[model samples]
Target: MADRVASDHESITTVRATLARRGSTSRPAIELPDEQSSSSPDSASSRRDADAFPAGEVVRLVVDGSERHAKIEEYAGDRSIPGAYDAPSMARDPDSASNRLVEWADDKGLELGQSVLVDVIEEGFKYGVREPGERVFYDATEAPDDSLASIAQQLEDN
Candidate 1:
């Protein structure tokens, strides 16, 4: 009985240590829209409206040294939800956002790794290389001059 207890204690300690390490290294969760909803007519119409809006911005990121483009409005999560309890809760699953991006890329015949360096190019938002898997939360409050050149410049600096 004592031996079993000791072994269990050791296992618990190892698990705790692993969790702590992951917590420290983990990036913020990326929130992607549900695939099912994205195909609905309502969602499609909304997407068209968003594209027509002047506030729409396009962000470009270098995935494996190649330029990849994604609409800022597509992955920015639902803005309707207020505050911390938003549509894509950052606390849900660390890989959710990254996986979504990877899946999208894969569908386009582009391969992405477990980690990716993202350069966000939305206007009015501070341009920078987002942490791996962080682009899903990318958002902008005001529209700026949308420029693909600026994104390329930021990527060069990184």
Candidate 2:
């Protein structure tokens, strides 16, 4: 019984050490710019670019020195319209603050697809000391113009 107990303790210690090492060696998450697209023929470059940006990733936003988190939501339509591409919608965690922000924008006559600036805070940093790690600019408008398909076809022909 004593030997069995000692063995289990040793096993637990080894496992804990291994997990700690793995955690310490882990790399930070890489975020890619929205402007970069990966349609390149080289698989390695494409993979690297694709790994740079995560879909629906959560980011911190600082508005008037107040900190809030938002998610990067892709609209995926005509890129010319503001919100038709990558946009960050204010995240609603425990309340409807995001909805209120949207309403405020609407009330202000900010058209959907118009650009709005959002300050994204850095992870694990004091908000006061760190300037926004990333500035997220998204279109305020939501409607997609169907006319872009004809333009795309024209470009493909050229």
Candidate 1: worst-modelled 10 consecutive residues by lDDT:
13-22
**Pairs clashing in candidate 2?**
112-140, 112-141, 113-140, 113-141
Q: Taking the tens digit of each residue's C-alpha lDDT, what string does model 2 give over 49-152?
A: 22222345443333333344444334452111011111133242323233323333445444433333221122221111111222222212122244773564
Off by over 4 Å in 2: 1-33, 36-53, 75-98, 120-158
- C-alpha lDDT (0 to 100) for residue 77 of candidate 2: 22
Per-residue error for 77 in candidate 2, Å, reads 9.7
lDDT of 1 by residue, 1-158 (tens): 13222111211110000001112433222222222222221111111222221133333323333333333332243211001111122213223334333333344443222322222223223222222323222222233343865675466556
Model 2 CA RMSD to the hidden true structure, in angstroms: 21.2
Residue 51: error of model 1 in Å? Answer: 17
